[model samples]
Target: MSETSSSVLTRMGAAFGSMPPALWRLLLVLAVFLVGGIAGWIGRGVLAGPADVPTMSVYEDWHLLCPALKTKDGACEISQDVYEQRAGERLARIILAKEKDKSMVMYVTVPLQVLLEPGIGLKLGNDQVRVYQYKTCTEEGCLAVIPVDDQLLASLTKAQDAGIDVAQPNGKAAELPFSMKGYADAYGAFLNNEAKRKSWWRRLWS
Candidate 1:
């Protein structure tokens, strides 16, 4: 070998000789791993194009469906003050339809495009959740019968805001906010109307 090559080899040999046998073996293994990784990375880059990365989205003031009796500009017009004023006064029940001889049931309407099988997710405030199955669907939308059970009524009384988790076919889900400002008052008034009030049923016949 040439003098320069021989000198480089001699220096390397001396350095390795000074290193512990275990350390030398470890370093050799590490060097091999690094070389293999680099080779694999280069090979992958040569074989494939850059990957498609998903983009994030940020929307400003997305319009939601109004849950109040009144709405303006796709938003609920009734504030907490208004809700308090008309809470019990506006409590009126409309019997959707009576089964052949079955009792009338209360119902809540939902928007179209909702998956009917899994039912709807109802979250009262930060906690207290329940799922109500769809009763039936019309051209307007689907209906969910709200049971006036003790727990549900109690939850509404303490809840400031409620959520309806709408299921989508694409696996992406969405939540709709429903203000429970005067829900308890209205529901209480409805409960007082025993003559009009009917047993809660899972399905609507009409």
Candidate 2:
């Protein structure tokens, strides 16, 4: 080739070499992320939807869900207020279904999950899904409080020597208590308690 053509080609090569390596790496990273996101969407079949999933009320650790204070974008502040209000000095959670039939009010005292497991054993109903873990506290003693993947099922399974009247679910979340109407009536004969009204502040927190 002629001298001028050789020099022009050399200048073009020099310009390409002078370009920042970081820019190339950044473009490569962007391409990889786009590919990964596409793959995940295809695998999960999640298309153009809200990514944020709300937690269930039954997972009773209110502290983590509580929002930050004195800052922008703090959603948990409302949750914090509500929990502080509903929560009692002593709290107990009831695992039960609400039904129109008075005889169907099947319920159990939610124990710590750590106490539930396999051959360890618990006498809950077959159709009974973990509906709730009601928190209860008295002046002297309290039930163990834990987060997700931990609840009454754990504790009950370990200690076969438990005293709760274990009953099987009657194939429905609501009807599971149908057979035990009279039994439930006679069991807790003492705590015929009246519901108390909560204050405005409690309502706000709640």
Candidate 3:
């Protein structure tokens, strides 16, 4: 053994370079890829939170029966005109079912003051002679925001004389503080908000 030369060491090292010997290297490469993929997947899951919905903003200058859009980052530019002529008429259904906030419902309440001068039949919580519109648009017939009170509905006729577009649609929609919901659902949202504001837990601890 003492006489053995260092040349034998080089030969021994070379012998280990066969195909089967490369098996360990291949296994290492596979393990690296698998681990990397799993890590990337986990990182993505952590980054995307519950409230995040991918959407672009919109810009809207003119509007009629549609909500205004602001400048946004998307392929399609949503306009007020397009929204009114053709948009998802299923607003109420979409809101009640999908809106994440359990405490409040969004409503677009058009005020009578904007169009009419005085003496309305229906009244809103704050304004008199009120009309709450439902977002019920159908192919044949669309639901108009009707004044709760019939007499107030009649009084709105005065707006017509003023040269204002004031034939109150039974379903009224206003940009100023406007939203759509079924009656029950709308009320429920209000209740939820009140409950949160006066939460029992907050009262007890505070």
How high is the CA lDDT of each candidate model?
Answer: 0.52, 0.33, 0.34
* Top-TM-score structure, candidate number: 1
Across residues 132-206, which tens digit of lDDT does each residue of candidate 2 receive? 332443443223222223244343223323223222233221111212222232222211210111234323433
For 47-152, candidate 1 gives per-residue lDDT tens digits of 7543423222211211111222121111111112111134433211112222333433335556677788888777888674678798888875676875555566
Off by over 4 Å in 3: 1-19, 49-74, 81-206
The residue-by-residue lDDT of candidate 3 on 102-168, one tens digit each, is: 3222222222333333212232233343433444434433333332234432332233221112234
lDDT (Cα, 0-100) at 90 in candidate 2: 21
Q: What is the lDDT of candidate 3?
A: 0.34
Cα displacement (angstroms), candidate 3, residue 100, comes to 33
Error of 1 at 149 (Å): 0.9
What TM-score, to 2 decimals, does candidate 2 have? 0.21
lDDT comparing candidate 1 with the true structure: 0.52
Least well predicted 10-residue stretch by lDDT in candidate 1: 73-82
Which is the better candidate, 2 or 3, if ranked by lDDT?
3
